[model samples]
Target: MGERAQQIPFYCDGSYLCEPCAELCRTKVQRQKPVKTKAYKFNYQCQCKFMRGGCKLRYQGEEGVVLSEEERSKQKEDYKKYLNEKLLMMAAREVPLNRLNQQQFEFSLESNLENAMLYDDEITRAVALSCIPPEIVDLASNPVQQLKELVNWFKFEFFSWCDKPPCPSCKSDQAVERVGSDTPNAEDREYHASQVEKYLCKNCKTTVRFPRYNHPMKLFETRTGRCGEWANAFTCLCIALGHDARKVLDWTDHVWTEVYLAQWERWVHIDACEPLFDKPLTYEKGWGKELTYCIAFSSKEMVDVSKRYVVDPVLNRMRRDRVNEKWLADTLQQRREALWSMQGDSQAQFLRKRYQIEQGHLDAGSAHKFPSEPFQPRQSGAQ
Candidate 1:
């Protein structure tokens, strides 16, 4: 019976200990170990999959593969050598001969203008005419005439004051008086200053002041303005006329205009604020040259004369102001030298490579896998 009972399985009958096999069976199940995964890394050279490309290259670590201090030092030295070689090559390159040709052309043109045997009118006409294309001769005799037509058109269209009939808005019948005409011999500076203070805008009938310290703000308030305002307005107008003009900034950052003269093949300075017809008079006290004023388009002679009166503030600054071109060049050279020295240092190269690795530059296949430290096992629960 006992042998049969052992062969047969026993059943539980509402008791703490059920069948013998059931009491012998283990309740706690062991957990399966987690599968390990491969880590990814980056490679700097020939970036490709190692297995597919038949590359067995391994990254020891960021510290091991990174450029060493010695290597960096050598690289820097090589960089300096490369820079010097490049600089020498640049020095060997010849400047184009055409540069001298341009300078010579400009010099000759300037000389011809200064010492020309022709009368001022003839010279101006010739230069102005030369600016016009041969195809356009039938339409206009010269550039000057074309410019006059353009100015007339501008005056008629944009500047209502240029229209032959006075504008109805400004009561154009009121005589347009040239301010400083009555005081021809008076001090120009004092006279111009006074006129600016008393001047009023014809359009808005607003009082305008020639800012003593800065460029005029309300330059376009009227059909006309004081000499300073006129100069700026004319400069802006010339730009609107499809002419290249820039405001000149001088020692005091004094404002003026430079106009491209097609005939002269260069920029010419002009001040419209000064009377167009006035000739500069020399002061016995050496207070500088006196400015003469003239009417706009008084004559071709007036335009030619005005050309001589213009000055370049930049040229004047270069001549009179202090500059340190050599010092600047030397400082730049020193900085280049320092950079080269650092690049050639092996230590720097090593540090740079390490930095790149820390910044994730290594390849995925060769990346290091760290082992986690074992944790303390818990004691068996109290019975």
Candidate 2:
């Protein structure tokens, strides 16, 4: 069984398992040398048939080859060696990945927004028509108007939000069930997918592939995914349309975009899924969602912009245990140096100063609490 499968304590299908039946399901596999793959599902009927739905807990089979003791030891040794090498590389600052929290920064930092510009004209026309009258047709002159139009088009007409994908074979949304997840294969990686969700169709027993494509241009073809896809593609489009944009990643398992409006000289929050614009506090005050780290990634720089979104710094700090704050700060500074090294002195200086100002705000925000008067629910479905 995979690491994640073994850790699950219960499954929710409105089914109950008696104590004895649950104990049997838990220990049966460990006590015997199993012939089947170690994966378990909570949907099976117990042999006892003691309960109404017969206990939705059963082992798939006892039918697979087992690993020997020697092989297990070899695997453990190899993993330890790999970890040692990874630690050395991280210590050298060769990679910006957080040691304790790998998800603190994106592994693939190269911008794919340039690919999105390939269809700039098509997107421009769509955005122009999306705006309200007196309709702003020439987006080149008015960047802010252009951004608003683009957001409108992308959110309402361009992409879709998928909760559970419809089963292709049975053509039923409810027929498909999530079995497990797997690493993206070579073909799926072409779309820049980090993971692929596996679903089983009850009617035809067909395994469906739901690759969460991260490359925005590739997403133009799929047009359907969760918040990750929506934010990715939208951020790409924002850059493609000549707006200075960044992909804002929330460690709390959400993402959105931040576009730098030169007119305002600051970044503005935008959520393509909710179709919301410039509402940084919406996640905290409106949805009552507690936030931790909110990092913004652009082609030039990676920034820590958590202060702008967090409701109460002291309270939210409790959830910010992924990495020591000082270590994270130092790592970010090192990464900024590396990323900005290629630019001219003037440009590099400008970015460095801007980053300093942003960090100052983060430092100041740490000392206070925010008002809770504007409490509201999430605009869309659950993130």
Candidate 3:
């Protein structure tokens, strides 16, 4: 004869389900009784197949009556408790942006030569810092405020250059070329070169390069340049001020700057290249996001001992030639790695695509396009 089946207790522990014989004597009991009048309510009462003397182990919650209000309330309370604990943990672990900025600022301050030409005097530092538009300064304090400052700075400082300036040679207002945009196009390059060659500076009667590409030209050489030159000079000035500033190469290879602000604890993007009359240049396609110029740095020993011998090779090279793909690719890769490791999602994606193009797996012509400029840095020009 078959052995008799043993009955199992419904509630065991404080919750439910016994341990020793619970697995073998599993069963389900419905709370509501079946109603034949209503089809949906029919067979409301059900039991687990195991309890029905069947080998199969099956249980259904919906087949039974709805949970009681007390049970529902208890479950909701449990969930709320879990969520509150999680929020508290997150709040406690959060790192303030100000802390990060302070750390970076301290780092920069400690890692420089005592008498580097960039910091020859305190006055130069003050001037350079002042030149930093409020937007760049506020990036560390408030990103939204920085963005507002950037828009206004670009509009008033750089964009206003689109207005025709009196020709340096003729002094005739009519000679001003109303270049709609400050972005150097192929035509602009030709015009700029032509103007430099033809127009003599009245103050010195010296022929000047129209679109200055180097510090000497924009600062001490001709003492004047177009918007593009001004943008580059401004970026260099920021870098000289001990700020981690760079010229960003965006769509059309337009120039801009990224400033490491101490208060905001982040690098804030700024465009000082917009011509006075033109709309701010926005990235449309290709050319990645921004390409930064690589500055050659010598060791302290070399900088000190060979300061005179270490001619301004990089500067001279940058003035006449466009940067090559190999150098750009390597520099971009370094920047990407640094950014990605820091959890910069958007910047990482942009760099990855640019890296693929630089490696020749993708054609930049099809994948990237930039504004026309004749004065790109050339590898051959490197001293």
Which number leads on TM-score?
2
**Compared with the true structure, what per-residue lDDT tens digits does model 1 show for residues 1-383?**
11111112222222111122222222222122222123321221222111121111221113335666786677557655654454454433433445454455334323322222121234333443443344434434464454444434333342222212233446553433322212222333322222322234456454323322112222343444333344444544444334544333222222234454556443344433321111121110112222221111110101112212223212221222122324323533443344335555785465345334422411221112222123222111110
Off by over 4 Å in 3: 1-124, 130-140, 143-147, 157-165, 176-197, 200-213, 216-227, 236-243, 250-252, 260-268, 275-281, 285-383
Query: For residues 77-174, what per-residue lDDT tens digits would candidate 2 score against the true structure?
Result: 76456544544443333323366464433343233333223324465435523432334346768877777777787778878888778888788778
Better model by lDDT: candidate 1 vs candidate 3? 3
Task: Report how far residue 276 has shifted in candidate 3, in Å.
Answer: 13
| Superior by lDDT: candidate 1 or candidate 2 | 2
Ranking by TM-score: 2, 3, 1
Candidate 2 lDDT trough over 10 residues, lowest sum:
1-10
Off by over 4 Å in 1: 1-142, 146-218, 250-255, 275-383
Give me the runs in candidate 2 sitting further than 4 Å from their true place: 1-137, 361-376
Quote each prediction's TM-score: 0.24, 0.64, 0.31
Error of model 3, residue 262, in angstroms: 7.8
